[model samples]
Target chain A: MGTLYEDRLAEHIGKECPPIEAVDTVCPETIRHWIEIMEDRNPAYSDAEWAAGSRFGSIVAPGAMMQVWSMAPHWPQRDLPELPIAPVDEVLISEGFTDVVATEQSQQIHKLAKIGEPVTFTVKLTKVSDREHKTRLGVAYFVTFEYRFTDPRGDLLGTQSFTYMRYRPEPESESADEPAA
Target chain B: MPTDWMKPHLKYDSVAWEDVSEGDELPTHVREIDTSLVVLGAISAARDFYPVHHDKDAAIAAGAPDVFLNILTTNGLMASFVTNWCGPDWDVTDISLRLLIPAFPGLKLTTTGTVARKYEEDGRQMLDVEFGAGTDYGPHCKGTATLRRP
Candidate 1:
């Protein structure tokens, strides 16, 4: 199973996943929701009047909210579309590396997330570990993926490189040895 | 959305790029994590429905002690931390984060940062800041963020 999946993962290297368009634009309602939850009081993000006088000349979404725009909706179960990393995940899961954890995320902003603007995200599978490595949870493989955010004109807005560790869960009996201290 | 959550407090109008120097320390900011921040930040704010971020049982099943904050929320907190220190006139041009540990609920997340470099690129003033957030378990995450001033 390990060798079979490992070879499958090797085939996906450097392939770009299909781009996903945001269901909503960069609008005030969504921005406000993020700001409220984050408790961020930045005038540039909420106060239109104050923002108009600033360098941005208008209210802008939080730079960190870039990824939120393109998230897949939570309701209305349909034939689930293959997620960007689903293919790779399938290979990992076949070998019992079921649980995943995000380890690193780095992003570069080229354009601000302006209100009413729609953003699209494109992901590319960059790297897959050649061999398994032992992790605290169990054995795992590290996968690296890159995300590119663009606008309607295809102008680059930002880019993020994210890394996740796909690991097998320890047996219940083994974990129970150190139950929550 | 209700506007009542908006706070009235404001930081400085802006930190001029010309005035900032390398090695300058930013004001430390602290936040108390609760189950609400973890869940809301995942589902409502970030639109992330990852179970480990909101369900303790799921997290424990996956080997975590409890529900923990997600990467998107940490990114938001990092942005807020920097802007609160440098004010709002600047825009984030880059942010790189490495997760060292899980930020579980009931811990005080203390964040600190320092201006690492000052330079000009493409006619815009740029600053690279090294920052990190930590809990009682040690560093939760740390990275550098680049800010551009117009």
Candidate 2:
């Protein structure tokens, strides 16, 4: 509705933040849990004996789990820093555009994560819509971030570009100048 | 329980890179979408805390019919589809995804793909597979995945 939020988002474009490491290193337990839920039965991901004979020579984390390895932890309430995009989302929320949804993602994998390796990620705001984009739900702004995932040795494992649509719901009735309580 | 007890019984053979053709078709993989997939996939698997992915009321309020699959899980499923077809030795080098519709509970998700290109890059045999997943409501997601042969 105003240029304030757009100006705020523009300032963040192309800004990269410090890399954040995963709370836990890549481990077998988490990999098992993920493939179990997805019903992925690939022997290289689950069977130790089979993977030992396979080209990998050991169990490997699923290539698709690249982002999962760096996802923020939920429980125990550790004192982790906020992602670089938190402030950008705050700027949008301040203007009543609170809801957000992932609309697209693209990943480039240089290497799959291996067991016992610590994964870290650095994120940069890549793009922001110059104007409001109208969608089925409501008028919105699209924000995109690029994430680079790397191993402890600083070797890149993968890269992902994630895009989210942030929007406010349309009012059912035409009400103007509604007072804030 | 011992990890040995967790191993699944092997059923399929690996696809060798030497035999892959540009027009080769991958076997279709079908999954039943339910509450467990939508919830556990978001929370325990993908570690996504986004309310719309796990909370039904929150999803409705956010303009979704119900709790839907998160992007990471969707990508994971797509990866599984490719690996399941190509077997255990190959490496997936890239995945590009475009979301069209929500994969909701009660829908049967089916993925099908074709090898779009077969070539050698930097002495590594590579295959680019164009894949798409859909349900009764039409296509849900589509993408191209690049696989490196071992």
Candidate 3:
């Protein structure tokens, strides 16, 4: 709704954000914890017996847990990287779309991850919707990022494309029938 | 527990691609999106430090009545909904879901899928499944998953 958004914000599409930090080699402890929380004891994930009998022939991390390796940390660290996604979000929030919500996510699980294989990810801000859309929440724009997961040998483990809607919520008018934003 | 007819055979705990055809239906799985999973399963596991996920106050400030489910958790649950039926041998190559409802605590998200199209591609046995998940807020996610069956 402002000149800044029309003139400057639209210029951010196709921008390349910084790469996420490399993680230490993948370990079973982290995968075990995730499996415990989701209660997804799919023998492939936890039961040694199931995995050994399965096609993989060994324990494999849940493909959905691919994001845990790259998301924001639970605690703030002084040496935290600049968060490759900051500029994309900060620019939107600066435009008065203070409310943010995950709108869609698409992931491709290429190869099942084996325990002890290292994983790292790099993200690129692919698109920032140029058009303003309205929803029950308010006015918003969509932000999309593509992530590539890799192992130490630079082999791709998987890939995910996530999109979020950044909007200014009008909580007073929450309605299910409201038009799409 | 699954019966003998449902158990996986040999090395793959899944249905063979030859046995499945287009228009086949997938079983529905109803999973709870409770407080613990929202806070512990979704946020803690993903290490998403956003207070909006753990702190109710922060979530309220973010225009949410309570802490809500995160995408990572939803992805996991949705994938499971499919794999749980396909068996451990099936491969989920692509899963795309769009969030329409904010899954709040105490809400149970039920998932249902229909085999939309089954075909061969790139030397792989593949099928496209259309899936949807719903809460009281209406459909929370609508998406498609592409899978390879052995």
Candidate 1, RMSD to the unseen true structure? 3.8
lDDT of 1 by residue, B37-59 (tens): 99998988999999999999999
Q: Rate the local accuracy (lDDT) of all candidates.
A: 0.82, 0.82, 0.74
Candidate 1 shows a clash count of 0
In model 2, where do residues sit more than 4 Å from their true spots?
Answer: A1-6, A171-181, B1-8
Residue A109's lDDT within candidate 2 is: 86
Q: Locate the minimum summed-lDDT window of 10 residues in model 1 chain A.
A: A172-181
Each model's DockQ?
Answer: 0.51, 0.45, 0.42
lDDT score at residue B134, model 1, on the 0-100 scale = 93
Clash-forming residue pairs, model 1:
none
DockQ (C-alpha) of model 2? 0.45
**Tens digit per residue, CA lDDT, model 2, A30-59:** 998898887777877778777778777777
TM-score of 3: 0.86
Backbone clash numbers for all candidates listed: 0, 0, 0
- Candidate 3, residue A86: CA error in Å? 1.9
- Writing each residue's lDDT as its tens digit, candidate 3 over A1-181 gives 4565567665665555455554545556777667656655356766666677778777778788887777554455435545445776887777788887888898988877787776777787777777777677787788888888877677787988888888887755554433332
